[model samples]
Target chain A: MDINRLERVSDFQWKILPQGKMQVPAIIFASENLIKEMDDKVYEQVTNVAMLPGIVNASYAMPDAHWGYGFPIGGVAAFDPQQGGVISAGGVGFDISCGVRTLHTGLKPEQVIEVQDELANMLYYKIPAGVGSTGLINLNNHEMNEMLTGGARWAVEQGYGLFKDLERIEEQGCIEGAEPDQVSDHAKKRQKHEMGTLGSGNHYLEVQRVVEIFDHEIAQTFGIKLNDIKVSIHCGSRGLGHQIGTEFLKKMLVNAKEYGINLPDRELACAPIHSNLGKNYLGAMRAAINCALANREIVTHLTREAFEQIFPGIELKLLYDVSHNICKPEQHLINGVSQELYVHRKGATRAYGPGHPSLPQDFQNSGQPVLIGGTMDTASYILAGTRESMQLAYGSACHGAGRCMSRRQATRQWQGNKLIQELAHQGIQIRSPSPRGVAEEAPGAYKDVSTVVEAADQAGLARMVAKLEPMICIKG
Target chain B: MPQPRWEHFEHQADIGIRGYGTDPATAFEQAALALTGIVTGLELVKDSEMTEITCEETELELLFVDWLNALIYQMAIKKMLFSRFKINISNGILTALAWGENVDITRHQPAVEIKGATYTELGVFQTENEWVAQCVVDV
Candidate 1:
């Protein structure tokens, strides 16, 4: 982006003063080099978010900010209902509650090297993937309602996972106030067979090995160790979520005018928090969140089954599960007064600091374990939330190395079958539904993850802990 | 008369689909062709089955989003890839027929799955000689 438009706040902080319709300033956290690599659209979209009604503080962009619908992908904004805040479907993104969950594999890389192909193939066979991939667990009408309202807890009750896993997940695996009736039958029908499946495009389940540790103490608290093997699942609510977003965004689009909302960009279609439309969207959005939590939990079950078949007596414990795309009501202090606000994180993770009641009891002394996914070929990182970040970024952190190249461009430059052979040479095994999908997700298509994480740490958005390199990547 | 055509444009993150025709209805049809192009080559998907789609909106732009998303919803629920689209717009309502076959991984070889169409870069207008409809699709 053009540095000329922004004033440098610090080495890692850049600010754009309120202009035109902007109700507040726009701030970005990134290294100078990362900033330069960003598209100018980041400035436009971040400023657009700032212009939204009742946006608290500044419209902040994480280090991995990229141009996305409505708000930028790494955009973080909170709206206060008391201040006539608005709820935007576009801001939450199409993949509702799309997030990452890491599991402790308790095995070494060398141990898996011998059986890597088998493991990858088994996972590919077991985990339903791709555009229309569906799981074997079909949901009846009642079961569908239970899944929507119950979330991962419902899945666990159905023997998909253990009860012990819920505590480590956001909202204890289910967000309250999900109104199953608000979700459309079309959305539900699309999800009936899609439960537990990983949808296509930029989604994956990867086996990774911790290659480096930045903060030993924090890494220890997160149960991460150097050279330790971990499995990370990257996906979302799938067809149901997409249908909800599509339906709601269109609803909000035409209704925005009814609420007297003057949208600078049509994609930023939204309704005031107190509006009936807003309430319905929230109800449905929460249900989608639950669906995602449940889907990931079931996939975790499948992964554990795969692991058990290969390494008997192995345990895959949930380290932490956090959603990057969501809007949740959170309490934070503003000018010495604690107030509840709805925070929207699109391609941004919540990184609550230590001592926050939300953190699991084991992690109270530490912070929320923020899982940052890398591209298929790069090193992902684990970061711990800090009080500084909570205050600075509304408990938000960058989600991943944002895409630097368009999928179309990536496909033009690389071929999927060719790239797979090349990654195999580097000892990274890849399994997917389509080879063309693999080509579109070429590793170089994304920004350098470590650099983004380093910038996030330097900016006090999240403190880096450990780095993970993918040993096997199952793409969808 | 303008020939129906579809092309892809580069958005920073998502793919932009643009279509052109001599008339507004044909432009919408070509837009569907652009949406079809995102997954796989049109030749790979044949017109073996037909699905009907209808959308209603007061404005042209919102109707365009509704039309595409309705097709997306059907595609997901039906698990099909459409190759040919027959669209007609009257007043503000759109009724159409989309034809294609079931997904064959080996034959179709779809590159990526489109989640939904977005209002970003959305346009529906008549030019000096033809009509155009375009929008960005989330994949």
Candidate 2:
């Protein structure tokens, strides 16, 4: 966090030159003020990531970078398998593929306000949330494997959502190379009853209204307009992902020496990409990605059902769903040569630039929609990928307004009940199972999202399109 | 002699749990209690049911993580919140019995679902007469 330790490349770019065991340099994208506010651990973690074997280019930190296990929360790094690249479970994080999805309600804020209270209560009741909550549907062993392999496409087969929704999702709702057999029974059992349920801790479903638009052309492309009501769901693969991460991290740590990995930190445990252990972890981690896709699809279905009950014949169309925690194989130009590399995004979102072949046809000119989640009382932004982002940090951007304070500090500074009352006074209604959960996620606990977004925009990581404010939130 | 107890340390993003006891086994037990305490108050959970868990690792620090992760798995699958723990460590194996009741959302007011324990700041060490076990947990 000390500016003196880093060399300023520009107003929004700071660099840590490679030294000692570092194989590459470390770069952080943030404004001067934001950089000064970052925890010193970000410097340590990002440099530590640069030390990993076969890491390509520099280790990059997004504008919202914060201290996290192993890698910084908003960390991005690419590995070349041919160069002895390794895959790390810590890099992917415990909540595998944890991400955000935004939906268009096609209704104005006035229409939503007419039924806001009822809709809030209905969603809270219909959607399983909070600790110890279970969904109505349970998956047996056979169905569980099917879900793991099929992703949201599996959810559609089970009548959770429409088949057309796949196009808006990453990997068309189901990624390939997932071997269900690689996932342990313990992981599957933990997810059996957790499908369609929102687990607690910084996860939620919120109804928001578009308040500002930064780019009219991109906003129109994303189907955004001032005063339009939108619904966003934030969650991930739940218990299955957690178990897989826990098991694999331990395995990788125990086997690090065998893989010839010199770990600077135990939390950075990794294995060679071509090794059996790495293969097994990739297969299992991909399965968890599908599980997250399926979980979000089911929740989208429940949200649709809740909306239909309140406003008959309303259709909640998918805008875009993006995952922040993942290890994806992508092709990027390294020194003017296109090469395939495994890009690991921890608490960071992929921002594929315009004209990328993988993007949907409609978005070819506009680029991918980058959804940024905010606290219940803060404003969320919708950004578009820029061609510059592909070169900036492997086409990745900040995930959220990263936590600036610890939960314990947040609780001591503000009471949950009082915070809820204050938010209600400002016209934002909240429904949560636990007040303590609400307090820990208080808006004051996070850094200013606008500043972070501004930095990302200035750095060309992504270009902002629209900003939205919460109308009602159902916190998990 | 240090009394068996648990407390939370501050991490930038997640919570760090530390426990202190007269011996390593007791410290491990207290650490598990800290894990449960993250979800809900320990006083709210009842010791109505018991489950046995066992895990082995060559390293004490890894075994400590495995012990807590095993308890996390049990809580998720069994839908239970533990109030008390009994741990016995011999060689590299840890055998333990945890007692608690089924999760009651209304009664417990659980706050967060702990993902798992991480190796960050992980340790099992002795100071004077007290054994300390500590690590940061993903919530």
- lDDT (tens digit, per residue) of candidate 2 on A1-476: 88999999999999999999999999999999999999999999999999999999999999999999999999999999999999999999999999999999999988888888899999999999988999888999999999999999999999999898999999999999999999999999999999999889889999999999999999999999989999999999999999999999999998999988999889998898999999999999999999999999999999999999999999999999999999988999999999999999999999999999989888999999999998899999999999999999999999999999998898889888898899989989999988888988889999999999999999999999999999999998
Q: Which ten residues in a row are the worst by lDDT in model 2 chain A?
A: A408-417
Candidate 1 iRMSD in angstroms? 1.1
Candidate 1 error regions (>4 Å): none
Report model 1's TM-score to 2 decimal places: 0.99
Instruction: Give candidates' CA RMSD values in order.
Output: 0.9, 0.7
Model 2 spans with C-alpha error above 4 angstroms: none
| lDDT assessment of candidate 2 | 0.94
TM-score of each: 0.99, 0.99
Candidate 1 residue lDDT tens string, A1-476: 88878899999999999989999999999999999999999999999999988899989999999999989999999999999899999999899999999999888988989899999998888898886677989999999999999999999999999899999999999999999999999999989899888888888999999999989988887888888999999999988899999999989988888898888898898989889999999999999999999999999999999888888889999999999999999998888899888899999999999999988899888889999999888988999999998799899999999999998898899999999999999999999878889988899899999899999999998889999999999988
Which candidate leads in DockQ?
Answer: 2
Q: What docking class should model 2 receive? A: high
Evaluated on chain B only, what are the TM-scores of all the candidate structures, in order?
0.97, 0.98
